[model samples]
Target chain A: MSLAERMLKIDRRIIFLVIGLCTLLPLLYPVGLPIRISSEVRGVYDHMESLPERSVFLLSIDFDPASKPELHPQAIALLRHAFRKDLRVIAMTLWVSGTGMAEQLVTQVAKEMGKEYGKDYAFLGWSPGGQAVIINMGQDLYSAFPSDYGGKPTKDLPVLDGVRNLKDVAYMVSLGAGRPGVEEWYVFGKDKYKFELGGGCTGVMAPGLYPLLRSGQINGLIGGLRGAAEYESLIGQKGKAVAGMDAQSATHLAIIVLVIICNVFYLSLQRAARTQRQIG
Target chain B: MDATILGAWVATGLTLLIFSFLYKDNPLFKLAEHLYVGVSVGYTIVKAYDTVIVHLVIKPIIENGEFALLIPVAIGMLMLTRYVPKAAWMSRYAFAFIVGMGAGLAIPRTISSFILKQIEDTVRPVLSLAGPDGVTFSMNRLSIAGLGKGWHEPASSFS
Candidate 1:
């Protein structure tokens, strides 16, 4: 076979290995890539920064463990920023599978800030109905969730003192994966309740939400791991998202190079075939 | 060792088992795949029972003397009739109620949020529009500074 044909027929496993090495090597040995903060991510940070002390900030965690890596860091960075600003934060999940992770994550961040549970924040855990739950909360917070995740009465909690319903919330953000997530939150929660809302979604869903953001229905969007990294940078605290940027950069470059090489070899193989047929 | 640390080790091992499939499909990969799905489903069921059955229904009836809640509970239970071949027709009532309530709640919002507003944004002039981020920029003055943005630089550094 001609060299061009041989290159064209290279083993699929070799390509996998090339991409794998591209990701794994940079992760193990850190080569910190300078990450530019996009305005979409900065919009989230700036809004949180503008909130006054004790202002109500509700976060809806609308993703399961399947989306943990991408959405979790975004949650952490946002939570840290909220607590740092002394915002009274209330977190809940519309996705049942996300309840345990959301509980643990909010608790961990709250503890790091040395913020008291009832006073500084409340974890409302997961409720069954997706849209109905938001509508119920819009009317009466106590009716939707009588108690926090730990089963403490929410009405009595200092963190939710003035928060009778979704309308009471000053600013809210939904860090979500799919359906019954950012879209549901907007349609059922923000559209009706009139609360200022923001969104952080898996990279795939981010593009879909840009329209809502443009309409000012949502204040901002944090998209996928890259968005998470940008928020971390804004907070001046680099976490797992920042750590993964090197790997992300390397992987993207390797894929681009592989694409170029494949095209060049493909063209050469076609040329060789035409020349051989003509000579014969 | 701490329970948290033990959990971390278990998670790491399972992750590695999942990644092993990239080399070749094996029994180990299959095991991890099934385990992940099984665990997630099992957890979902247990949580559903707690949130829906216990908190929403049982606790309200017992604590607040809200026996009226049983009406909706009965509607929900009618879905189980699908298991009986003869009584399967009864399940439609449950489906009807759910579909009706859902539509009543969703249609208006869908129109306002998706269709009408989307048209507004679509027709809105480019210069007049502000990005969702509130950072307004026009195509005319779009500057492409920091051209490379280190995308090509990182991989080269490792090499």
Candidate 2:
């Protein structure tokens, strides 16, 4: 068979295997490549930096497990930043599946940083009425999220003493995946209530948010695994996002190389076929 | 020690077993995929009931005696009308309530987020250097400078 024919007929399983190996190998041993920090990420970091100590910030984990490989790292990186800065954080999840995972992550990171829950941070678990809850927060904070993730009244939490509405919030970062994510926050919270807003989103949804970032609707954006890596870099704490970047880079480059090789093989075969036809 | 390591080994084995289907279709992947779906759906239902019924409905009535919740309770029941084709129009109240609330929730945010914010960020200049007085500033300032502290002259003017 001609080289082009052979290339065209290569098994899809081989391609899958190649892609898997390309992604897996770098994850096992990372290259520590220097990452360019986008302003979208720096915006959130800068916003947090600019906040006074103990500023009330809402860190919303509006994502689920399917997005864990992307959004989980963002949650961790942001939580780590908030804790490091001694910012009073209120963690919550709009996604049901994310509640347990987000809680586990926050607890682990908080412990690592010696953070106390009710005193330093509080996690107000999932709420069903999404945007209604956000709007209700504008009118009455306790009515919106009456209880913390553990079922303690948010009204009585020492950390939330004076925090009554979005106006009381210094800045809000919504680490999100889909509907009721950054968009919901900007509209419900930042629009009418007028709170500073930012977000971190999965790769697939990142492009849609660029216009928002450009407009300053959101102060910053941490996009996909790359955003998480950049945020991790800023905090000077390497974690899963950084590891995943190596994998991402390797996989992207592998796909490019495969495309190039296939094209070259195709062109060579075409030239050979033309020569044979001319002679015949 | 052996048991813990063995458990890890078993986990690794199951992972590989499930992943092997990427090379080709297999019963193991099917079983795992079905179990995952089942568990996920169960979790979602329980969560929904806890939040929607228990918290929003049951708790409200029990704690506050806010019988006004029946409006939402009726709307919630209307959602079941979807299963009966003849009575599907009865579901419109539920749809309208949900969609209306969604729109009420979405429209204002859309205006603030997309409309107002777009104008603010776009019409704003990128050359205000009052924010950073350093000799050099990041290129972000060069592109969309909005009221910064440091640079007096526009970078465009310098070039």
Candidate 3:
């Protein structure tokens, strides 16, 4: 068989192996590449920085384990920022599948921050209705969540003092994977209640939310692991997102190289075919 | 020996097993897939029951004396009628009420939030020259034209 033909017939396993190596090597070794911060990510960082101490920051963890790689770091970074600023955080989840993960994450971060539960933070966990929960919270927080994830009455939580409804929140962000997420928050929580809002979503959902961000319905957005890495940098805490960037960059470069090689071989094969035809 | 460590090891094994599908699907991959789905569904049910039944329903009604909640409770109970062969038809009343109430609540909110507010934002002036002082460029003027011919030169040259 000709070289072009043989190349075309290359086993799919070889491609997978190359990709695996490309991802694994950089992760094992270290190439510290600088991550450029986009304005969207910076917008979130700046707003969080500008918040006064004790400002009510509502964080909606609206994703499950499937999105853990991307959204988890975003949550951690945001928690770091909020706690660093001494912001009173109210965390909740719309997805039932995500409730445990959100609860664990909030607890872990709060412990790291040495922040007390009732004073510094409260987790309202998952509720039954998606948008209904949000709407109910807007009207009255205590009615929607009588008791938080830990079974403490939200009304009595010192952290929730003066925070009666969604409108009482100074700022909010939803790290969402799907529906009952950022869109639901905007529609049911922020738009009518008139709270400042931001968003963090998996990369797949990021482009779709840009219009909302541009329209100022969402004040800022953190998109995917890259956004998480940027936020981590902004907070001066290098975590899983930062560690994974090397692998991501390497895999991206490998794919780019493979595409270039494939195109080159394709052009050469086409040229050879044309020359043979002319000779015939 | 610790439970957390054991859990971590299991998680690592499952992750590797799932990743094995990259080579080709096998029994290991299938095992991991089924385990993941089973665990997720089981966890979701448990969480939903905790949040919906224990916290939202029983706690409020019993502790807080929220008797008005029985309206929703009764409607929810009507949905359980679907499991009965003869009473299955009765579930339609519950469904109808839910649909009607959902529509009543969502329609106006959806219109205002998704449509009207978006239109309001979109219809605003794209470029406004009006500033606090006068009609100066209200936006940042960091144009490529402002960067002269030597803009591409290294900073070392300027130094």
Candidate 4:
């Protein structure tokens, strides 16, 4: 077979194996490539920075496990930053499947930071109503969440003292994967309540959220794994997001190289076919 | 083994099974895919029952005497009529309630959230007519010029 034909017919599994190796190797032995902090992400960090100590920061965990890789790190990074700032955090999830993961993450991070529950933080857990939940919380916080995840009355939680509704939250950031997430919070929570809102999402959803970011609906945006890496860099605490970036970069590079090689092979084959036809 | 370790092993095994599809179609990949769908559906059903039936309906009506909640509960029960062909017409009440409520909440907000707000941002003068000092240009809130202090700008083609 001609070189072009041979290359074209090469087993796809080989390419898959190469891509897999590229990802695996980087994850095992990281390059620690310098990650540039995007302004959208910095928007969240800076807003968190600008908040006064003990200011109430609401983090709506609006993603499920399907998006865990991209957004879980974001949840962790944001929680870490919030705890570092001594910001009082109240977490809830619009996604039912995400409740357990979000609760565990917050608890784990809070424990690492030596933060007390119901005093330093509170997790309200998941509820059924999507946007209705947001509007309900805005109207009557306790009515929406009669009891927190641990089944404690929200009315009596020291963390929620003097917090009447969404209006009282100093800042709110929804780290979301899909619907009933960042956009719902903006339309139903922030737009009506008028609280300062920020957003974080998987990279795929980041571009869609830029308009919201630019329009000031969300004060900042943290997008995808790279955005998670940026937040980790901003906090000066390297974690899973930082580690994952190396794998992402290596995989992206491998794909790019493959694309170039494939194009060259295709063109060469076309040219060779034309020349052969002319001679014949 | 404890749930955590057990979960880890199951997850790892499933992950490998799914990855096996990278080579070619096989029973291992099919098993993992089916398990994923089953688990997802099961989890969603349990969650719904926990939140809707136990917490919202049962706890309120039985425990707190919030009987007014039954109105919505009745509507929800009507939705179950969907499975009974003859009684399916009763489901209209549920659909109507949902449509009416969803539209009420969504229409004006959709216009403002997706349409009007987008138009405003798109057309808003990024470079304001020159003021006394100079042209008051607005950088993206994430931009270095706009972000101001703490953390340098992230270098990305998009940014």
TM-score of chain B of each: 0.75, 0.66, 0.71, 0.73
Q: Where does model 4 sit among the CAPRI classes?
A: acceptable
Ranking by TM-score: 4, 1, 3, 2
- Predictions ranked by DockQ, top down? 2, 4, 3, 1
Residue A38 accuracy (lDDT) in model 4: 83
Which ranges of candidate 1 are over 4 A from the true structure?
B124-159
Decide which is better by TM-score, 1 or 2: 1
Tens-place lDDT digits, model 3, residues A1-280: 7887788778988999999998889889969889999999999999998899999999999999999999999999999999999999999999989998999999999999999999899998877889999889998999888888888778889999898899899999999999888988997778768888999999889999988888778888999999999999988999999999998889889999989988888888999999999999
Candidate number 4, chain A TM-score: 0.97
**Tens-digit lDDT track of model 2 for A33-127:** 88999988999999898988898988989988779999888989898888888999988877887777788888999999999989999988888
lDDT for each candidate structure? 0.87, 0.83, 0.86, 0.87
Per-residue accuracy of model 4 over B6-97 as CA lDDT, tens digit each = 98999999999999999999998999999999988898899788777887789889988999998987898999999999999999999999
Name the runs in model 4 displaced over 4 angstroms.
B1-3, B126-159
Q: At residue A258, what lDDT does model 1 achieve?
A: 82
Give the worst 10-residue stretch by lDDT in candidate 4 chain A: A186-195
> Could you give candidate 1's per-residue lDDT for residues A172-274 as a string of tens digits?
9999899899999888888777888899999988999998888777889999999999999999999999988888889899989989998999988788789
DockQ of the two-chain complex in candidate 1 = 0.32
What is the C-alpha lDDT profile of model 2 across B65-114, one tens digit per residue? 98999987888899999999999999998999899878765765675567
Provide DockQ values for all models, in the order shown: 0.32, 0.37, 0.32, 0.33
Scoring only the A-chain of each prediction against the true A-chain gives TM-scores of 0.96, 0.94, 0.96, 0.97
Q: How well is each residue in B1-159 modelled by candidate 3, as lDDT tens digits?
A: 999899999999999999999889999999999999999999988888888888877877898898898888888898999999899988999999989988977776776666655664554443233222221111122122222312242222100
